[model samples]
Target: MRLYSVIIPVYNRPDEVDELLESLTRQTYNHFEVLVVEDGSSKRCDGIVEKYTNKLRLTYFYKPNSGQGFSRNFGFEKAKGDFLVVFDSDCIIPDHYFETVEKYLDKHQLDAYGGPDRAHDSFTPTQKAISYSMTSVFTTGGIRGGKKRVGAFHPRSFNMGISKEVYQKTKGYKITRMGEDIEFSIRIIELGFKTGLIEDAYVYHKRRTSLSQFYKQLHFFGRARINISRFYPDEIKLVHMLPVVFTLGFFLMWVLPVVSPVLFFIAFTVFISFFGLIFFDAFAKEKSLQVAALSVGAAFTQLFAYGVGFLTEGWRKLVKG
Candidate 1:
């Protein structure tokens, strides 16, 4: 059995760390070691790590505040495993996660890999709605973990793993944050490292608890996409522009009423139909009207916020360039 080093980078989220560690304690494959890297958090999880010392092969390190990408690099430097895995502090690993990864690696040869994230049954309705909007085919979320992606599968840090050789050659993430994972994944692929998706090794990712928080997160993500394009201009695909189009159309809808009533009605109907599609799709998957209704808002929040961020950041890049 290969040792898998699980690296978690956290900042002022002890409660979330406690929950994530508790879930790790139940893993069916027990050959992994856990390293919790505290990125300058005043509300540290050292106490929480103490609780797990007896239960897991756990180590806790306290370091000055750097963003998550570099913090994960710190853990990777100290890992004792054939494969180094990165997980966000806000995630709960499924019991079968390691087992599934090991099984997949036995048959296939991948230098790096990533898995999808799902909302746990215990997550709040808003969280579930957010998850739907993120994973739904209606949004760009489909390309994230969906089997058929726009291009090569770029492993996300939230649930990503790489062989020791890959890390030794590439030296982990270059930037600390702002689409650091995407940037790292792109470099890994460009370096001729074999990267792929592990479908069954999924994690329960509890994203932001509220729609407002989710909006901010997505807005930041939109900006991050532009940041990635800075390093590799061709990384910006047509699919990424959908949100910007949606945002522009949203503003144009209000303007249409003054221009012509018929045009306004046509635009309004098109927008309503799109949202209606999201509502029914969410309802079919969630099987709850409340979640479905909230999903519409979540979907709108995801696209609109992302679109605004993309435009703002794109403008900044243009001016600065």
Candidate 2:
């Protein structure tokens, strides 16, 4: 069996790190090494990660407070596995996750494979909606085609794995605060590699629990998109524009309320209702007040943040140019 290197970038979440480490130790696929890249987390977390030193083939590296993309690049330099699989600290993988990934690639002769992320049992409806919305073409900014292969240049690191060949070709992730996965995937595609999606390999993601946290998450994501624009100028298109559009829609509803209240009200309702359909679908499999609230809040807050952030990004880019 070829060895797999799992690089986890962590900062300020010692508890989640412990949970992730425990989950990794339970993996049935034993031929892997774990690299915990600490992005200037507190001393407390350093102590926590140290406990796992003897338990597994784990290495901990500390860098200044760089963001996830940069931290991941740091970890990649230390990895020696034939395949590198990146996972966030908030995820819980099944025992068969790595085994499935390895087999899927070997059998299919695929160099890169990405899978759908499963929701954790604790996710509220809003978190679920946010997760689902982010996965679809609306947020992902994928090139549209009916082809079975999507996300060639729009890869998400949530549950993605790639061979060392792609890594050497792409030279790891560019240092950015947002859309690092997407940008990296774009480079991978530019370098000419085929990406395959594996439906069965799922990683359960633990989402943000509160509305405040959700908004901040989107705020950063939006700002990151702005940061990414510095590198990929044309990336300002639709998938990146959705946040801006939603923000504009909300602003216009208020700005034009007096002139055309009826039309504005109807347009707002229809727009929200369309998203509401997606929210309902998110909660169809599960039900609860917390879930319902989260579903709505997740959608609104994320779109709001993304929209606001995109404008901020655009303004900054304009000034720089």
Candidate 3:
């Protein structure tokens, strides 16, 4: 049996980590070992591991608070499986997730694979809305093409797997604040390896249920983009660039409204159009009023928060430069 090493980098949230372990315990596939690398956190999580210490294959490592990129790299170095799978601490996988991934990999002879991330069904309407907003074309920066074998310009490391040779050849993760996954995937594509999305390999992610948590997440992403720009110059493309542009456009148009009503109209039109698309796409899935409200609020919140974060980071980068 080809062994798969599932490497998860966890920090601070012991409760979610417990849920992750519980999900793993129920997985149908047994040819896997889990390695949980604890990035530096103030809370002690040794007891969490103790619950599953009976598994001889389970290993835990503690390192000073490094970013997720470094924690994942540390896990990759210690992984002994033929394939390395990485998941965020909050992800809850289906029972057949691994079996489906293995089947898809062998069936297509692909180098890497990922799938759709579904928001937890049990989430509140606001949480579901935020989750949908993140997945929406507006907030996700627009991922085109419906083909299962679609390659993202910037794919996430959250639900990704790679061969041992791929890491050995390219070296491991970069110590970036964010977008390390994109950099890593770009390298894989450059190596001429195929990446696929198994539509059936589904996962449920816990969306941030509160505004405070949501802002913190966006803040990290904002800081991450700043650091990644140092390496991948084109990291800020149309999908990501539009929101910032619109934000600035809104501000500029506000000052010049008396000069050109057309410019002011255009700015508001774009803003409405952007949110319209998000709401339309979300409602198409489920025509519930709650979902609609959540979707709209989430989209607005993300755009506003992300725009502020981006400009803040941009200013800091410019000052440093």
lDDT of 3 by residue, 206-248 (tens): 8587767887777667666766787777667666665576567
RMSD of each: 0.7, 3.0, 2.7
RMSD of 1: 0.7
Residues 286-305 of candidate 1 have per-residue lDDT tens digits of 99999999999999999999
How much does candidate 3 score in TM-score?
0.88
Q: Which residue ranges in model 1 land beyond 4 Å of their true spot?
A: none
Q: What TM-score would every model get versus the actual structure?
A: 0.99, 0.87, 0.88
| 2 or 3, greater by TM-score | 3
The residue pairs in collision within model 3 are: none
Minimal lDDT window, size 10, model 3: 144-153
Order of the predicted models by lDDT, top scorer first: 1, 3, 2
Candidate 2 — which pairs collide?
125-291, 125-295, 126-294, 126-295, 243-307
Instruction: Judging by lDDT, tell me the better candidate of 2 and 3.
Output: 3
> In candidate 3, which residue ranges exceed 4 Å CA deviation?
54-57, 144-154, 260-266
The best candidate by TM-score is 1
lDDT of 2 by residue, 1-321 (tens): 889998998888888888878877787888999999889877436777788888779988888988888888888789999988888888888778888887777788777767777667666565665665554443444332213433343446867788899988888887645778878876777777887777778887776756788677778778877776777777666556777887888888876678888888897897778667655655564465455445566667777987887788678878987
Model 1 residue 308 CA deviation in Å: 0.4
